[model samples]
Target: MNPALIERLQAVDRQAESMGRGERSAYLKQQAAELGMSLATLYRKLEAVAVKPGRKRRSDAGKSELSLDEAKLISAVLMEAMRRNGKRLMAVRQAVEMLRANGKIEAARIDEETGEVLPLSESTIIRALREYKLHPDQLLQPDPVSRMKSEHPNHCWQIDPSLCVLYYLPRHGKDTGLRVMKEEEFYKNKPKNVVKIEQDRVWRYTGTDHASGTIAVRYYFGGETSANLCDFFIYMMQAKQDTLKDPFRGVPRMVMLDPGSANTSAAFKNLCKSLDVHVQINRPGNPRAKGQVEKANDIVETAFESGLRFTEVNDIDQLNGLAERWMRYYNGTQIHSRHGMTRYQAWNKIKAEQLILPPPADYCRELAVSAPKEAKVSPDLEIRFGGRVYSVKDIKGVLVGQKLLVAKNPWETDGARVATFDADGHETWVAVPQVVFDEMGFRADAAVIGEEYKAPSHTESQQHAKELDKLAMDAETLEQAAAKRKGKAVPFGGELDPYKHQEDTLAARNTLYIERSGQQMDYNRMEVAEQVLSKVEMAKLLKPRIEAAGGDWKQAVALITKQYPDGVAASQLEAVFNQLKTAGRLKLHKTA
Candidate 1:
């Protein structure tokens, strides 16, 4: 293996090759004796040092006995048997065996020389799976993500909630104090201890500005709830009093968050609707969509919450206060890697129009409870809400009689927002102003009475109705259909019988009457007559008045006798009763 030995062997081989066959053999024997090694050993050393041509590749070297399709079937079976955490529950051998038993895969090769039928082994199948990139290891990797950006600060924000495993606030007597949850006291073995303080488990809510990477964190006592999420969101939106300490506050154009129940709650969505903030809920099982807030949670845990172990914390308020202070310092001083500037500096670049200040906290809280109500778009392209009508003519793709979700717009006193879906099926809130009316109770935008005339544009419903008319009436257009029928065409091509049910009922009744009476009934003499109230009925009606009148029935009886000697007509009872009351005949005393 030494360079000198290799050179010596090469020289001996060159000299031996120059001699005749018998002389070359004698020369190699002489060299082997001189080297004190056997002739076979010398030949082996020479062969090791000799330069040989590269190994000849077969015509089907990369081809496998297991076909790509068969390998894919095996891979799919293994993948289906994998846990969500990417751990494979079924190995390649087990999967291959099961697939073979199920007759789902047939990967075999026939030897060209021997003509032998050879089935692919597990190793061959696994190799083919790798070659075709069908293995679970290759398929279960995290999806590739592209960099996302916002045009300006507050353009987009990401929020996420995480349970703080390090600490919990347990109530001692009447007051709650921060307590560290050690593994020894609260582990998998101690289920009761975990449940005992379930209500007291601390949850950290984190929000991050996508463009500036500004972070806002708040600690809550309980788990993720709509109230806590809304509270944290309001805190992020509301301007801080101490601007010198923290100034990152404004309603974002869009908010990206995980699709948790609390995050998708009606109250939280209503809050966003009122603020004109777009809620972008990431798809389930896709946390990377809101990776900013997820990372912020980790940063808060490491840089902020980790120090809580050394410091004293009394209650959730104090803990939040400490968190707020840390967030302000972190955002104001720490330079963000994305922009190479502090978060405050980056956020300060926001234009006045882009930075929309939120309403007061109380108004936001009120708005949170204002869930969207379904309102139908009227024929006049309007929706009624809160005793007022709002015009939907400006809303794109709006149609008459179409239902829309509407909620109160907190920014506008009399305006409401209509929840609409984009082409991508994402819910968006559009602010719709209330219709203004003149003093004459007419629309302010209405055309003048005589000077000018304005014809409203045709709605989607009208266009569809035209199409429907063509289909239903078998005509080229609505005008043709109208001219054909002269405004008297019945629906369904006039094939429908409108009074068939009524006719059937009358026929059945006639048959029953004839069967029971053994003859046709006389319809000409039948008549309906109104009946008058009986004396007993009149007395019952006047009983309450008579009782209130100190059991004086003489006045009531005298009036009834004078009004009608027979009986009082039911239609005239109200008028006659009122006359008796006004005539001081049925006066009732009021008790103190």
Candidate 2:
């Protein structure tokens, strides 16, 4: 309400109060005519101008009839019934009813007047759920996001892969040409056509420097796969040959991406590890964590891919060529909204040390998919990998016979890196140079046998072994101990019986085998004399014959038992059972 209008309405109300009741209606009508409104509008304006007290709240206005625990139970039931996409499949009323009926929740209320217990209404339950923030809508919302920043260009890069919606490359003889995915042919209804062109559908991989917003887009055939992701990542890192046009190339300190299969693939992770790049995979369904690259994807679709409809392209190479030109032009010319400068200009602020260049494309491709291999350190303190011996003696904590993870060093051609874990289980890499041999086929550092003698330094294990020997032999020097023993000393002073338990277990096993063999021999002797058949065996043999002869099995069993007081022999029981069944003395009892 306007202050001046409110003041005028208040003055009118005061003047009406001073007038008699008969004169008040005419005065309000005259004021309404002057204000270009009806008498009812004037009265309504007066009511709006007047300060009214708020409605009286109940003693338990904010309190819920349903307890917090009951509301949570109702929420759990509804949330459990929700679809994975967060669509509520169960209504609040349905959930409350089901929970109450199943005794999972109780929100019973005592009627004050009637002194009867009553269950909470659905409305009350819903109000409580919302008030307690246990509703499905509130519980299913995405977590709040915090803004992320990169200190400098190449400090952090965000990468994402998306399927291109507009164009797919169709092979024309040996060449490929771009074609639009029309609704008539490549729609949901035309699944066969869609599948036929699945391999040709173009996938776009977009990367952006988080600080500078320099976008690098590349197109590949098929969907998002490890190979395509690696290729794009390598392209983003390796220095471009045409630096004048596109200078945005360097290995970022960290790469932010979603937890996509390709982004989190073992091959991709190995590559990132090899490049010394930190891989920051955001939580699933959290794309805003790498919003820069996600937005870059959209920009490419609108600013670059939108132009493809007006141009003709041959093959993926030509398409990539166009994309490269556009990327350079856009980054070099258009001012970024965040920094108020062109992306290339902001990126050029990168310090020399901050811009870490990548290895050649081929080497990087190898690094991307290659996992570190475990190689055991030789007695000579060297490890053999890729048919080359690399000395690992200088690496701290490296021991002979201990396996170390070895990978090709990206920075050095004839060197390899050894991976070792620290106390905190974080991986650290130590570069090891390949061993070079002189003309004598020996290591260059090896001592000349006739000219000089060089005793190898004792390793930690050797030192520890010496200390162990001193304690075990009770001698200050190993030589003194050897001489004192004279090769006749018994280890542990012959007191410890290392094999006593083994011998005891073997004797017990032998005794068990002997008992088992004796029992088996007795059983075999009984079988040779024809073992007596049990009641079950007699019935099994007689059942088929009795059924064929229509004889009663009970009567047959009685006759067998009377003839052979002891159980009949297995060989003779079958013949006796057949005779009884054939004698017609064991007929099945007929029903009345």
Candidate 3:
């Protein structure tokens, strides 16, 4: 009747069915015996259980509804059906989709990774649209939009990088990490964009100005980094400086960049500061945030769409010149769509627009945040502060467990918490002692519990071991003679008398072994218990505290032998020592 009882019967039946003979009846009997019930009782419980179906329905990918408004309208229709029928989640979903398609809504399915909207499955779209209560007209038709004007040339230069088709395509070779990338795992891009040399691959960099419709495309023959981005900024600044007439001598104070590897680097940040350029991090992963640059990228890509091919373009000087020429052609000569004038003429429309310039340079520098806290050094060459990774200079007093200050800025209101390094990286435990453990919890009477054993150290325990062992052996032999003298024969013919067996004198040696070995818990058997004490693990554990004196793991092993005199063997000690050394751990050295 209970789930557990039912499962046991089923297991028995299964085991019976898997056997060679038709032992169904035997399984039923066995299960009944275990449950203390008859076979008929088990059969009654099984009748209430039902078998489930295994077929699965395939999912559609298209969107039936287009806009939010259209989806809502369709949802109203589907919701009405579900309310009338009181349907399930799946049934309601199906009804909504059916009505979405009936309304003839147009919507596209999109891929998250690629950001490409595609024509979707009609049925799937219909289902999704109906759930939203979409309307056909709302999605099928929409109006046009207006555009804004730019004020002057070089006023706003938008920058972004798109891996050309070649950059995304599969290539044959080991990756920079020396790992081989298979075709599927590798990026699929235009083959012409990424040029490969004898061993390395290179990338291209491009920039576009909003006002002049000028596009500057430079080939950056390497992967993205802050350094590469710094170079781009330097080149653009120098070019702007060279082209300036006697009147316009200033740099482009505000430069916009879409979020990319080359854009958000530390080197780029440093370069921007030195050049007095304002740096703004774009809304991450959102391309629409940099709409102007997005459009410029589209135009530049369209121009080179025809002639772009695979060529080992190594000369950056020539590449930059061509990019400048392309910008000139697009900006000075290309006719504007909104205005019949060229880009220069079109920019004049916004030339009268007001400026929102930055404050004085001195103020921005003063308002800047402080950097991360550095590791503190003492005169004795010890790291006084929390030991964490610090800049490798003339470090003094540095210790392994020191914690470092990780502050947002040195000027932040709250001081930073101490951070320490684990195998992963620097981490600080936010919880203070009150959370769980306390140093005071370790002792009851201001006496160090087992840790501070002033009475007798392990070596001293070994010194008294021979005397203790002889007394223990004598007591054990006396107990055995007393047990034999008593009329307690081997219990009902070799049947065990657990209590008297424990009183056996020979077991005294084993009990002493357990006590002296410092292992509080008894293992399943005496031999197994001894074997555990005789293992490499315990020896290896002592290796560290011993080798802290030096790299000789043998010294650590020797300290354990002195303390645990007759305990673990030399072979096991050597084995553990080699294991630590091979694993790059220095064994501890302990003075006996």
**Most TM-score-accurate candidate:** 1
State the lDDT of candidate 1 residue by residue for 1-592, as single tens digits.
Answer: 7888789999998898789999999999999999889999999998887777799999988887787778888888888888878888998988877877899876778889999988777777878888898888888888899888899999999999988988988865765667678898888478898898889899999999999999999888779999999998999999997976687998999898888999999899889877878889899998888888888988999999889888778888899889888988899999988799999889888999998988899889989987778999987799999999999988988988889888988878888989878899877788987899999999999999999999988877778888887776778877878776687766667776889899999988886434454677777776777779976788778768666755456777777777777878788777766676677656645655
How close to the true structure is residue 172 of candidate 1, measured as C-alpha lDDT? 58
Q: Which portions of model 2 miss their true places by more than 4 Å?
A: 1-63, 112-115, 172-176, 422-424, 438-442, 446-592
Q: Give stretches of model 1 more than 4 Å off.
A: 1-38, 45-51, 172-175, 421-426, 436-456, 463-592
Query: Candidate 3 residues 1-592, lDDT tens each?
Result: 6788667656665666567655767766777787787778777754544333586764643433256764565455554554323452334345445654686543456778998876556565565555554533233333343554445655666667654433322234433221222345343463442233312443556665566554556556446665556555555444242342111112354567776766866556544443345566676655555577677667766765333343333344554555566665666677876556766455434432322233233322322223234445322222322232223112222343444433321222222223333466523222111112247643232346577654422233344654454353443454553454364544333544668766776667665434454557966764433244453567556556446645675644555555555556544755655555544334434557
TM-score of 1: 0.71
Task: Give the Å shift of residue 275 in candidate 1.
Answer: 2.4
Full-model lDDT for every candidate? 0.85, 0.84, 0.48
Could you say which candidate leads in lDDT? Answer: 1
Ranking by lDDT: 1, 2, 3
TM per candidate: 0.71, 0.66, 0.32
Q: Per TM-score, what order, best first?
A: 1, 2, 3
Candidate 2 residue-wise lDDT, 333-370, digit = tens: 99999999999999999999998989989999888768
Model 3's alpha-carbon lDDT is: 0.48
Clashing pairs in model 1, backbone N/Cα/C closer than 3 A: none
